[model samples]
Target: MITPAPNVPAIASTPTFTDTEIKPSQTIAANTTTPPTISETLTLPPVSVIATEVPPVKSTPKLANIEWLTKFRGIPGIGVNPVDAWLNETGTTSDPTCRDTRSPSCDKHYRDPLVDNWAAIRLTEVKIVFYKDELEKLITFSGVGSSISNWFHINRVLASSWTTLVGRTYGYFSLEGDAGNGQRFFTASPYQGCTKDRIFTLVITKQVASCAFDRHSSYPQFLFVTGDGWGYPENMTGIALADSFAILIK
Candidate 1:
């Protein structure tokens, strides 16, 4: 009685089935499209097709310390003549009170003897030649604004002018510092240095000049002479004047 509790479970009645065909719409809709599947992909690095490179900059020099490296001597002695100037009197050497400063008075002129007419040292003879030597020195002054602890001197200076005392038209007096500008030149009383005393012999190559005879500019100018020795400005002024001139001190 327990045998096989009815595999079919005892349907009210055993039924028989007949096979049928599927509809056209049903088969077409299900199979017409395909399903997506698992797969792989790819990528790349960074770079530029049109690229370029770059660099840096530079600097320059200072002129304050080396003021003497330039064409301070001015125009050459194209028309200057020569003279014979030597120390006379053979007196003991003395220090100059001139202090490199000048005034309108003839007595205080750096180049004037105490007596206006007393020739200090006749420099008109070699004034131009001294400048010629100076020209050589200037040739090497290519430092432009670079510094130069230079020493300009003159054993003596004569008039560069042919007629007037210090005018270029007739003669050249002496050169100031650079351009007739005051910054170009200076003259303090002699002090102890390699640049003291040699004012008269200052073969200063880089200097300019301003003259009552032929001034280059309106600014006051001076002659800076420093060297190994001092001279008697008094004797230099009276008759033994280094020459007849008025110079502006710093």
Candidate 2:
């Protein structure tokens, strides 16, 4: 009985800032292919008010490039939290060719390195409204301890919270106050999954705010993939999106 061994999954190429071909399930062995790396930078507005006047006219959180869109994955019903009906999570079955809309799911574990996808499509980039905590910043950041300004940007990321029923993983980045200071802030993080084969990339530099990863290798079967996109927590709701779109290149 010459039973052939189970075919090892493909060893897909590393992710690139501009690579359009994507796939599902990949597996690189020890001393195998190198994973891709990514990073991103966000342009934000200033946050300073030193007025002794009383009327207290407020300003909207000015964010550039706002968009709104939707997605459809297999695990969850329909995702309305991020936006409207176009977003979904309908492809969580064992079937490799299930209806995979690509919307972020609150539950259900998805296979990575999928045989059907290579890139994410933009859904929205418009604006929404959220009421931020109006508490006054009592700490007056000055000379010696003046680095207090940078704290705002860093803190926004650290203090975000979300609870997923499917136990998915994620990461996010955005400029803090650099936009106000004529500088841009960038944060990059990789997505995590239950698979030890889990991998992602994050790169932060002068004019780039991008990230990339593969749940499985392009060298592997997309049907067997297992990972999620970088996390976009719910706390970011009503924060206003600039513009968005989705893509299917492979």
Candidate 3:
């Protein structure tokens, strides 16, 4: 330390630094070890690929023809809804095999009388009622040779009433609206042409029968197919005839 003169500030000593030597925490040896080489090559079996063939498309019915009448309305502890009333005591039979005392009564048989069936029956008035929300449609009617049949021409659709006819009625009539505008109608047929073996579907929507009723009508009605001398040949060979019908709403 040096002495300071009077009224002069003493100088402070500063620390000096030089280059320092640094060493690693531990010395590592060079890796002289080598992985063992694969002495022999492995062989794999050859694989064979097979091509798959696709089958041809076949025709089938368009609608969901359920066995509704037998399973619901006429069964034990079951009956038609209050809104539904049968105008004809005998319902039409598209296929006689499905006909039984348990089936709804109608007056027409799509089955030919010569082909072992009951007499052709006729119907007049009918009523189908349901809650407005419960109707998503898909209601279906069955018949033979009706695959290509004009569903809308079966008969005139009307409003809910006591004298409603519900069966094959031959005539051209108009409903209040088209499709979903106010009313809608849909029909489907099997992929195959109408023979004794083929079945067709007839659908009626919850549209307003504005002829006698208003657009706010809750029930839609149908008439019977009274016109005759139409449809497929009554007699055929090995037709495997089977006619059935069902309707679903809810």
Candidate 4:
């Protein structure tokens, strides 16, 4: 019976693996987590922008009341003998007469109470000029201080006076023009600073007037023409600063 026992191969037993045990030939998979999905989106309000503007400024001075200028009685075409009347009104003694032999004219100088008392300006002398025919030709207001401090007050007074007489404001840009009749108005100033010579003139005669000191040919002559507007002669030098204002009448 022993001999008869066939030599059968011994059967191998199957191995069992525990939960923490891993076989050498087996591969283990890594643990992965699922991602969460978003449901809503965020939004913001839009911004806005805006713009702005501005205005311009003026450089000229304000105009003043010039009623005092019209108060004078010595204005041309006023009295039978305007020169004498003006002298009487101004209470001036005709002691020192302004006589020019070459030119057929007579001039009387005086100090006017109205001008002296005027708070607006300080004028020392007023002169009345007459032609050979004894007709009033020119009335001049003069004697401003030569100081620069007097410029503002003087300018204001003259400007106001011009505005009152001409019915228009005095501007450096528009100095002279035809003021009706055979008359012409002119305004001028010197280029120099701190000088007290300025003149505002109104030519009242139809004929050309002698601006010369005498009948000398070398002297200047003033010719006034009529039109819409007229300007001073180009050859004319110096601004109208005569420290005086003259009104010539017919």
Best by lDDT: 4
Give residue 151's lDDT in candidate 4 (0 to 100): 24
**Considering TM-score, which of the candidate structures 1 and 4 is the better prediction for this target?**
4
Over 93-179, each residue of candidate 3 has an lDDT whose tens digit, in order, gives 345443443355433322222212212221222212211122211223223222112222334334222122244332222222233
The Cα RMSD in angstroms, rounded to one decimal, for candidate 2 relative to the true structure is 41.2
The global C-alpha lDDT for each of the candidates, from Candidate 1 onward, is 0.24, 0.24, 0.26, 0.30
Candidate 2 residue lDDT tens string, 59-178 = 775433333221122222222211111123222233333333333323332333331221232211211111112211111111122121232232222112211112333233222312
Cα RMSDs, all models: 21.0, 41.2, 21.9, 21.0
Candidate 4 lDDT over 54-134, as tens digits, reads 344666753322222322222222112222333244323232222122232233222334433444555343322322223
**Residue 118 of candidate 2: its Cα lDDT?**
17
Q: After superposition, how far is residue 156 of candidate 4 from its true place, in Å?
A: 5.6
What's the lDDT for residue 159 in model 4?
Answer: 23
Score residue 43 of candidate 4 by CA lDDT: 39
By TM-score, the best candidate is: 4
Q: State every prediction's TM-score relative to the real structure.
A: 0.16, 0.15, 0.18, 0.22
Give per-residue lDDT, candidate 3, residue 151.
Answer: 22
> How does residue 37 of candidate 3 score in lDDT?
60
